[model samples]
Target: MRSIPSHHRLILAVLAGACLALASPAIGQEAEDGLEIGDAPAIMPVDPSDAGEIERGARPSSSTGDANRLDRGERDSAPPVTKGDKPMVGGEPDALQGINIYLRMGTPLPDVPPEKPYEGEPDTAYGAFQRGLFLTAVDRALPRAQLGDPAAQTLLAEIMSRGLGVKRDLKGAAFWYGQAAQGGDPAAMFKYALLLMEGKEVPQDREKADDYMRRAADAGNASAQFNWAQILVAGTPGVRGLTAAMPYYEKAAEQGIADAQYALAQVYSALKDVPAEKKARAREWMTRAARAGFDTAQLDMGLWLVNGYNGPRDYEAGYRWLSIAAARGNVVAQNRLAHLYINALGTAPDPIEAAKWYVLSRRAGLKDPGLEDFYLGLTEEQQKQAIDRANRFRRT
Candidate 1:
C-alpha cells in the first residue's frame, strides 16, 4: 500500500473541528405547558460561513491520532470552534437572523399537580400563546401577568418581541422578559440573554447578558448550556477551559445538542489524559453527531474509523463517512476521500476517483501538494474523466 502524506492529519483535524462546531444552542424543555416548542421558530438560520473563534485547547494533537494510521499521519482533534449570529452592537446585525426562536419556549402551566383531578378549565391562554394566538394569548395572559405570573409575563414578551398580534414593541418585550427572568423562568432567561446581546431592542448589556445566559443554563435551558459552554471555552482556551465547559456540554449533549456531542467526541478520543470513561463514550457521541447531519462529525468519524483511534479500523465505514462529508462540500473530507481511493483502503484503487475528489477540494481552496503531484501524473484521458466527475459533483 502506498503511504499517505503526514500533513493530511492537520488538514483533516481542522476540517472536522469546523464541522463539529455547527449547531444551535438548546432551548428550554420542548414540552412546557403541556406542548412541544421546538427550537423557538426558525427566524432563519445564520449563514454557516461565519466561523466563531478557535478554541485554545491545551490538548495536544490526537493520541497518535490521524486520519489514517496515526503512526504515519499523526492527526489530532482540531481546536473546537463555534458559529452564531453574533450581531455586535456596532456591526451589521442579522436582524432577521434567529430573532424569533426565543418565542418558541413554553413553560409548565402548573407547578404542582392538582391534589385530585379537580375539574378545572384547561389553561387555553398558555396554549394559545404557544400556538401563535397572540391576541387571545395577550388578552388571557395580561391578567395573570398583572398578577405576577412568570409564564404569563414571558408570553407577553414573546408576543411583543414579534408583534405577533400587536405592533412590534421590542422595548416592551424586554420589560416583560426582564420580569419573567427575574421571576426565575428559564425560557425568559434564555430569550432575555439573546436580546441583551443583540442590543437592538433594548440597551446592549453584555454583563447582564452573560449573567442571564448562565442563569438559563443553570435552569436547564439546553441552548443556554451550549452557549454558556462557548463562553467558558472562549474565556479560557485549552484543557482547563474544556474541562470546565464539560459539565455544560454534557448537559447540552444529553439534551440532543449535536455541537456538544461533537465537542465531547473530540475531547474524549483526540485529546490526551482524559478519563477512560470519557474516551469510552467518544465513538458513541461521534456517531450521534454524524447521524444528525453534522458534516464535520462525519469527517471525524471517517478518520477515527480508518485510523482506529478509539477502536479497530474499519476502512469501509471510514469510506462511507468520508463520502458523506465530501458530498456535503467538506473540503477536507474531499481530500481524505481521494486518499482513500488511492490507497484502496475500502474500495478498489481508482486513480480517476482519487483525482475527482482532489479536484473538488482544490476548487474549494484546499491546496494539497501531494494530491497535485498525483493529479499531474494522471493520463490526459483519466484527468478529463476526473474533471468531468468533479464538475458534476454538487453538495447534497
Candidate 2:
C-alpha cells in the first residue's frame, strides 16, 4: 500500500470532520423526526449492491468509520469492518469496487423497517401537510410556511409541484421552494433551483437555478455542489459553467463530498478543453475521489488501468475491478465486462464465461442494445450449460 502523505492526511481529516459535522445534524434531525440516525448507513458507505437493482453504477465511496452497517431492512448489531485494509468506506475494496485484488465481499442489505416520520409529539402542521400530501393540506402547509416553518413550506412546495397531497400547482411549489430556500434550507434551495431549471414549478429560469445551486453549494450541500459542477463543466444552457463551479466542487470535495470530487476529476479529464497539466491534476483528483470510495472512480480507474491513461497498463488488475463491479450488479460494468470478454482485453478468452456473466448483467438490468440482444440470442441449453459451468467455477 502507498503511504498517505501527511499533508493529504491533514486535509482529508479536516474535510472528513466537516462532512461529519454536517451529516451529524441531519442525522440527528431525522432521528428526532422518528428515524434513527444509527439505523441509516453513514454519509459514506452507501451499498453498491443497489447498483444492480437500480440499473446504474453502485453507490459512491464513504468515510473512514465502520461503526454500524445498517441496511434498508436488516441490522447487524456487530460492526461491519473490524480489520485493517478495509476500503476507505466501510466495505472491503473488492466488494465495493468489484475488484478481486483484496478483501471480502461487502455486506448486503438486510430487511429493516422503512424510514417514517416520528409519530409521537407530531408537528401538527407537518402532520396535516404530510397526511394531505398533494391532496388537501396545501392551505394548512402554506399558513405554517408563512409562520416560518421551513419544513412545512418545503412540504407544500413538494406537494404542489408533484401534485401529491395538493393539486398540481407548479407555481405554488416554486413559491414554497423559494420561501424555504430563503429560510436557509439547503435542500429546499437545491430543489427549487432544479424546478426552476426544469420549468416544472417555475419558469425555465436556468439562471435562477444556477443562482440557487450556487447558494446551496456554498452552504455545503453535496448534491448541489455536484449539479453546479456539471453546469460549470458543460457551460451549456447556463452562463457560468465549469469555471464557476470548479472551486465549489473543490470546497465540497475537501469536505468529503464524493460527487464533487468525481465531477472535478471528470471535468479535468476532458481532453478537448483540458490541457495536459490540467489532465494530470485531474488524475490526481480522481485518485483522491477513488481513495474516498467513489464508484465512478472505480470504473474510471479500471478504464485507466486498461488503457494506460495517467497510469501503467494492467489488464489483469482492471479486469479484477471490473468483475467486482459487475458482481455488485453495475450494469455498465457488466456491459464493459462483456466487451472485455469478447475482445479478451485483460483475461483469457472464455465465451462461455462471458455469456454467463452477460446473462447475469442483463438480469441486473444493463441496457446495452447490442449486448442485450446478443445475450438474448443464446440457446436455452447453451445458457443453462454456461450458467452451471460458471456456478461450478465460482464455487471452485
TM-score of 1: 0.66
The candidate maximizing lDDT is 1
Please identify model 1 stretches exceeding 4 Å from their true place. 1-122, 130-134, 160-172, 270-273
Model 2 Cα RMSD, 1 decimal: 18.9
lDDT of 1 by residue, 1-396 (tens): 112122111022322232234322111111101111112211111222211111111222632433211121222233222233344444544344453343335432334455766597677678876654456666787778768889888888777777665666666677778778878899888887776666555566667777888889999988788777766666555666667777887898899977778777765654467788887998999999899887767987888898886878899999999899889887788899999999999889999999999999888777889999999999999999999999898788
Pairs that collide, model 1: 19-296, 25-223, 26-222, 26-223, 27-223, 56-238, 58-238, 62-76, 65-75, 66-75
User: At residue 76, what lDDT does model 2 achieve?
Assistant: 36
Runs of candidate 2 exceeding 4 Å displacement: 1-145, 149-175, 183-185, 236-241, 255-258, 271-297, 328-332, 339-349, 357-384, 387-396
Candidate 2's residue-wise lDDT over 20-121, tens digit each? 342221111110011111111111111222211111112225412321221223233434653433455444354444443333345544446788876676
Measured against the true structure, the TM-scores of the candidates, in listed sequence, are 0.66, 0.46
Instruction: Give all candidates' CA lDDT scores.
Output: 0.68, 0.56
Worst ten in a row by lDDT for model 1: 27-36
Best by TM-score: 1
